[model samples]
Target: MNIASRPTAATPPPNALITEAVQLIEEAGPLDDAAAMREAMARRTDLPGRIALRAQLLGQRLGLQHELARARQWAPWIGLGLVLAIVLAGLGLAGSVVGGAERRINIMAALVSLLGLHLLTLLAWLLGLLLPLRAPRLSFGWLWMTLTARVAGGRQGQAPVLMRAATRLLARARLLPWALGLVSHGIWTLSFLVVLAALLFALAFHRYTLNWETTILDPQFFLQAVQWLGRLPAVFGFATPDAGVVLAPGGMADAAGQRSWALWLTGCIVVYGLLPRMLLLLLSVAMWQWRRRGLQPALDAPCHRRLAARFEALAPRAIVDADPGAEHPPAPARPLDTGDALLAVGFELPPDVAWPPAGLPADARALRIDGSAEARRTLLDTAAQLRPRALLLACRAAASPDRGTERLLRELLAHCGDCGLWLLAEDGGAALPETGVQRWRDWLRDCGLERIAVHARLGDALAGG
Candidate 1:
């Protein structure tokens, strides 16, 4: 993580081993400044005392991805679980019962049955919500807060341990709402499904229950339930009910009497209509939680760690100044501050999904680059106008020149040094043109250019042509 050793005007080395080393450093992830430096360190062969640095860094990334994915996957379930608990609590408090008259389950009994479920759901959601706060390896919030603290606190001294711990706590606290939201959502969905299933089962079982007084049998009880669902919206003023059409549940009657359709209708409407709206409400709340709390702020958001690595590769000397000590008077109070040691990895745009340029280009910049020599010049000129120290060039794999493209390569290589160049071939199929491959290699060697890092769009090859 020594930023002071970077070269000021470095070029990619000709050796494949050296080039691979540099690319690894620049491409390392975790999206932090200090992490970027470690990635950069992976390029240095002469650094002693650390043998497994590369493996350790790679392992860290793999582990983080696993942890993050797991966390994300659990988010929805946690939300749903909380929602279910709330629903159960409501039912218990309301003393809601299931089934028709004469065959109905006791309201108190239903509530008692749901109490165990409520407690378990509560425990599960609370554990999930709090796990991020306690887990050290998954402390993204801590990392971001510390980065912000460093930026705000100045770079003159090392960060205090207390401050670091405090930031971690702050990060954990920040994520609590998101976790709770997810739990709430999970609980609601669970409860809704449970109620819907129970109601369906009850309706099915009760449809043919014989009344001693009634001789008639109804065949469309399930169908009537569906119709009740259609009528539910009208219950809430969605549509006016026709006058004199009020439907009310009637108790069982004597044999040869009309069947009780109202009872069946009530269960169906409540299950299909009311439950769905309640579930939607929970989903909306969860979405709001996601938008407000889970999403990282723009400044505190993660950036590509590779940018710093690429910068270090193109101009290592620019970053590493042997004079960090030389600038200040030697004093007990004064200490060299690395100040977060973050680097902007190369600029990473969202990946381009299209291939063959389709009708328009996949990327406007790419279209301009592969269009003509003048277009390339125009792009370079525009970039120069912006005074950017580096430019990331994305070219189609198929568009990469072959034997016939030697002249293009020579031309591109000749002018690429004006600003640090990052030539990105979007497709893995893009090969060095055959005639120019050896020449390009030699030229790269002569100019000390390192390996060109390849970024393949996974599944892009399989996309519709």
Candidate 2:
């Protein structure tokens, strides 16, 4: 498969697009530096016009890894629905059973079977929200992601770069557990409704009495509880038994009473079990939508930052050269000593300039320092350890000498006492202004360092020295 081929004009779904992009980035290898990768992406002429550059990159990669695209699109929903159907069937059959030809359901037992675990799970979910606890692993969302990872062979091998990218995107969207919970709760509501339907079907073909018996509770307690529970269902025109009916010693065995009891049970399931879960499902859906709209890949992440810088460098921008100075005299040609290690520090060189430019001696080692504080610290530490015989500091000639530059020079001088200091001026394809060159020279002299030699390139300095 042509992994580098651009995707056709038709755009896939967003999730699919993202998945593809991640695959492409991984296929391209380590993106610690994205300059070459971006270049490769830009050269792809066949990428769809409608998709953004980021999406296009992914799609191209997806096109390459075609073998891994055989996920069962309908499996998650079908599996969940089948499980709900099984639970409903089991519960309905269990509730329909009778003993000694009495054919009566223990009201308390039936209610507990229907609502006990649901109520407990709801309470636990609520507590999870209030308390500092990790997300539940048993959630539908967790299961779905795990299943997807397994199907995609994500866990069996090293995690690809795109997988990490996808994770970051989801995290930024802030819809991990909540989105999963929504699916789970929606399934729970459906399961309860299915059970209710099954119960109604069972009632059509068979006759059963509903009764409550408790050793610890009096008849009045049961009557009051029934009245309280029946209030909501009563408003919807479902029948509720009065004091005489609740207090009856033989229980409600007549057809009308049985009908009333069935309506009351269905009402309780709808109002308590199904209704709240459905509401939670809706809430999660809304939250996921709200958060998804704000989804954007974090630009400051290292890989993304490098990609952004690369794109920025590619854009056309006018170069304003403040230095028009006569070029410094070329240093006399001399081969670099075999034992001297070359420590080269670049102070914002142009993107095109390669560090430790190709001609250095075999023994030389190089480090490139950018604007990051941490990188500067690393540079200092590395320099301390290497203690090279020569120190080559390279900076753009167009950049004005600032106090930060002064401080850096002071620190390096202090650390690498009396070493050969070469200030390599990179003109960035333009001549440096005479004033800029003198400014840097004057600054170095003020630091009590007079023997410093200036060169336009490291190769020239190495050749001269």
Candidate 3:
């Protein structure tokens, strides 16, 4: 990535990001002071390079290189799984429309059957992106991460850090949506292609009588619908069935009428289904590529700060006499180490979600944040005083993770040694069209909550670290 020569927003490559995350983990481990000093002094490259090289050296020494390699392969594997799933789904939807080749085909039913789930999923993705939730799970990205951790057996080693680091880097770059969007649109494109192919084959071989049968509605509704839906198809050479065929109650239409209906159906799927998805796939690809190049690290993060300090301590100095009159640079500050206490806070949670968590030690303290500045200040002050071993902040699942929420989390996190985010999912709360658990995880990852213990259940969130 050549971070030194690049612009300020320079992004490390995926491998470098993984290495840097490993560096953070190593720095947080048992501090062997003399060993660290010797390692730091031996490096003479740019800070980013030195940091990356340090992780590589540590990984080999710790026998974690295999874990890193496995972690790097996860994204591509899960992505392939996503593509295969989508293709089968498209084929299944199309097959449902064509199976049991009877004489009659309901145009309305066919259209809805073919595109219902696809359109619904598309809408959900749009909402997730628009709300700026940065939904890493809106597609299969979260599943990819989870599968990676489990499959790679990352519960103990560098694999866990690798997954978290990847998510954080992608989220921090604001690339999660675009990256997932590209996968989504690409898969959808392939699915619709399958649909188009299936439809073409059915139309070529199987002849079905096309008719619209309504119970109580006026016939005019059916006539107008045909014209409205077929307008785009007509612009391309596909013909809409005439009023006689459109209003026909049974399969009374001639062969020509049947052919027009088939063409109209095929055209609608192409114009409405295939072309739009294809265009969106192109759009997603462009956006992802454009944003992919600048995945900057959170250099100001406490973990990085501590490591940078250690590295600087052994930094080479030019042979010059110390200036007695010059002011000395202050030593870097160390983050507060955790004590034995745990603090559980519910941030803007509704009345139902239990506060103080059910089970805690006698020394543990709990509070609910009411979104007031005073309430937040009290919480931070309390954290500073308590120096809790672990802090679990429970928040509403359905609520949009707005900027204010992120800011509050960032501030509270600094006061505690380790943090867990409990996304409180109430029984009746409004949710993303998909699951809310993953959506919140996506937001947390973007917040740079490394190796975050994201829990749906309050118990798990408050469990011993």
Candidate 2 has an lDDT of 0.57
lDDT of each: 0.35, 0.57, 0.67
Order the numbered candidates by lDDT, best leading.
3, 2, 1
Candidate 3 C-alpha lDDT tens digits along 56-129: 56656665677767766766787788779888887887777776557467778888888776787777777877
Better of 1 and 3 by TM-score: 3
Candidate 3 — which residues are off by over 4 angstroms? Answer: 1-12, 23-37, 58-65, 72-77, 101-103, 134-138, 141-145, 154-160, 213-220, 319-465
Query: Against the true structure, what is each candidate's TM-score?
Result: 0.29, 0.54, 0.60
- Each model's total of backbone clashes: 45, 10, 0
User: What is the TM-score ranking, best to worst?
Assistant: 3, 2, 1
Q: Which candidate is the best by TM-score?
A: 3
- Quote the RMSD, in angstroms, for model 1: 20.3
Candidate number with greatest lDDT: 3
Clashing pairs in 2: 20-58, 21-58, 22-162, 323-432, 323-433, 324-433, 324-434, 325-433, 325-434, 334-464
Q: 2 or 3: which has the higher lDDT?
A: 3
How far residue 393's Cα lies from its native spot in candidate 2, in Å, is 18
lDDT of 1 at 137: 22
What shift in Å separates residue 334 of candidate 3 from its native position after superposition? Answer: 37
Name the weakest run of 10 consecutive residues (lDDT summed) in model 3.
Answer: 425-434
By lDDT, the better pick of 1 and 2 is 2
